[model samples]
Target: MPDGGLDPVIHAPARLRVVATLAALGPGDELSFPKLQKLLDMTAGNLSTHLRKLEDAGYVHVTKTHEGRTPATYLRLTGAGRAAFEAYTTALTTLLRGTAS
Candidate 1:
């Protein structure tokens, strides 16, 4: 067995946190921009930058909508995102356990 490789895209700290947060949500559940920002304790610009990277990787789906008079953004993990996150975790776990696959 060979060691599993880590995914650079999902390995970044900020992006990893974002993906992990989304993975914890229930299926079909999404976190609004404000909520996610507050939860992660990140500034809007920082979160947006990381999210853009994830979105470009097809790991997240971001939707914008108007809530009454205010604009709102929502983010959810796509199937691909979930699978990638799972793989990343598995690889990390294997590495920690000194195991190879």
Candidate 2:
């Protein structure tokens, strides 16, 4: 979006999708990396990159461990992240409504 245009609450499509998915799940529920990848239909590398961005932004928390033979990665949203996502959705809704009117 342009500087004068509406500053979107969720700027990146993939990030928005991630946040939206997390919001749909029960609060504090953690999603495994592979599961989230399947849900988003995103590649491991791509998902990792997006997740890194979210992690850096303090929107998501990542945990890595080994489940016997395989490695596991889990993601959960932070309180601030959840609140920001909610605000963004609300802003988007209002903007869409204004345009419709």
- The prediction achieving the highest TM-score against the true structure is 1
The lDDT for every candidate, in the order shown, is 0.91, 0.80
lDDT of residue 21 for candidate 1: 96
Please provide, for model 1 over 3-98, each residue's C-alpha lDDT reduced to its tens digit, 9 standing for 90 to 100. Answer: 357788889899999999999997668999899999999999999999999999999999999989999999999999999998899899988898
The candidate maximizing lDDT is 1
- In order of listing, the candidates' clash counts read 0, 0
- Checking candidate 2 for backbone clashes, the offending pairs are none
- Number of clashing residue pairs, candidate 1: 0
Candidate 2, 10-87: lDDT as tens digits: 568988888888878777889999899999999999988888888887888899999999989899988878987877
lDDT of 2 at 59: 82
| Model 2 regions more than 4 Å off | 1-9, 99-101
Model 2 whole-model lDDT (C-alpha atoms): 0.80
